[model samples]
Target: MVPLKKYPNYSSWAFLAVMAVGALFCSTVIAGVTGQFNLAPVGIFCGLLWVIGGALCFWAVQAEQDLAGTGLRSMSVSILLSFFSGVVIFQEPTLLYFSVPAIACMVIGIWIPASKTKSVWKNWRSLLSGAIFGTYLIPYKFSSLGDMEFLFPFSVGVCVGSVLLVAIMTLKRKKSFGYPKIPTLFAFASGILWMLGTLAIFWAIADDGMFGYAVGYPLLQLNLVVNQMWGVFVFGEYASRHGRIKLTLSTIVILVGAVLLTLSKM
Candidate 1:
């Protein structure tokens, strides 16, 4: 476990590097499999990854107060991995100039440290979560199943995987399946929002060809901006003026990168 301290040490850097590598490898393998496999098995398998990824995301937010920056870093990693997998395995076309610059901008932007006490393990967990989240659409693009058809099994897999994980976690923690009403309501609301957003993606992809997927992928990454706002304004992730400036500049870079990526696909 990485100790939350004034600055990350060499061991901290090592942990982050190893975790990032592992996350990247997992994403690449998933992408490769997605490009070649049928949706039946792939959807099930990918759903399981999502559950693991979701858990990592939870851990990440719990470990750090700068929720937005953490989310952005993870998303930035996914952006690069997604583009690579799309082109290599799925034969998607991309202009080198735009794509390379976009990736560079995102990486540089995310490199600006978000918190004083960054936990390497938690940060890497977020990266792994983003990696898994990034693979959500890869299999769907290759599947012959209709949008709704694929969504059904995929959704089922997600539910099953989530329930199993939650149950196991609860058992290990010796906790009851109970929560505060307000938080539970908010969680439900978020679930609804997620479902709607997902359905929209499915519809867009089904209607607009791979072009839609490519375009939507980067646009959705704009959520990083929102997360940052929540971090700064709502969560007060950065109190110092200098830190806030760094976060702002990083957000701009990330947006620019996202736009460039979108244009590259078009």
Candidate 2:
């Protein structure tokens, strides 16, 4: 097993990521036979494939040994999250929710990291994917299908999952590639946690979009911000570059922005 302390170089991580993609392709091929047209199967399948890919990736660069505890935990969490999503169905939105702050949440949820990490706008790619995810949980042509309000939860789950994965992968990647480094993958897991919870939020929103936005979004975002601050949950951010004081200030600002959003929505 590769020691966590001994970072694996970027080339090795990239190899694993590429292999993960191939695994995704392989899973996609397998998913074709399944009667379901939803992306849930593919997404859940990809989660496993990433694990296999990560393991293979690990083996390729390091010695032949089982993956580490943290890696195993991460995979387990992802699997559980996807499994939870698979059982639930996405419904249409019944309430009205949309505005600048909502847009800001969506943007910051995806953008902040995009700028700091790799591609800032890359989260948008998951729009279709997230929609697919939402569709699976929700019945087709539901009464509120035209509302599109519930898209927030679905999209957040997708956006967070996509970017956070990239972030975590980078954290584990060794320094050979020269990309900015994170000390550990522990924090990145928070993103996964929030994503998992979002699955519920999407399903809930499908039932009642307003509550989902006013209640659900705030709960989720608050949890997320807390995780970001704690640095123990998934994708937690520290105040290194921004500094502790600055981070605190930013949190307050975001909270205020979130409150404004809640008020506007209400």
The number of the candidate with the highest lDDT is: 1
**Residue 43 displacement in candidate 1 (angstroms):** 3.5
- What pairs collide in candidate 1? none
Q: lDDT scores for all predictions?
A: 0.60, 0.36
Q: Using Cα atoms with residue i matched to residue i, what is each candidate's TM-score against the true structure?
A: 0.76, 0.34
Each model's Cα RMSD: 9.8, 13.3
Q: lDDT, candidate 2, residue 206?
A: 43
Tens digits of per-residue lDDT for model 1, 72-179: 767876666666666676766677688778878877787775555655565687878778777767777776666555554555456567666666766877764544
Instruction: For residues 1-266, write the lDDT of model 2, one tens digit per residue.
Output: 12221444433343333333333333333334543223333334334333433433344323322122122222222322332343333322222244345435433442232224433133322222222332333232233332223333233233434345555766776333333335223223323433345445555344444544323433343443443443422233342555444445545655665565455545
| Residue 129 local lDDT, model 2 | 27
The lowest-lDDT stretch of 10 consecutive residues in candidate 2 is 64-73
Local error of candidate 2 at residue 174 (angstroms): 21
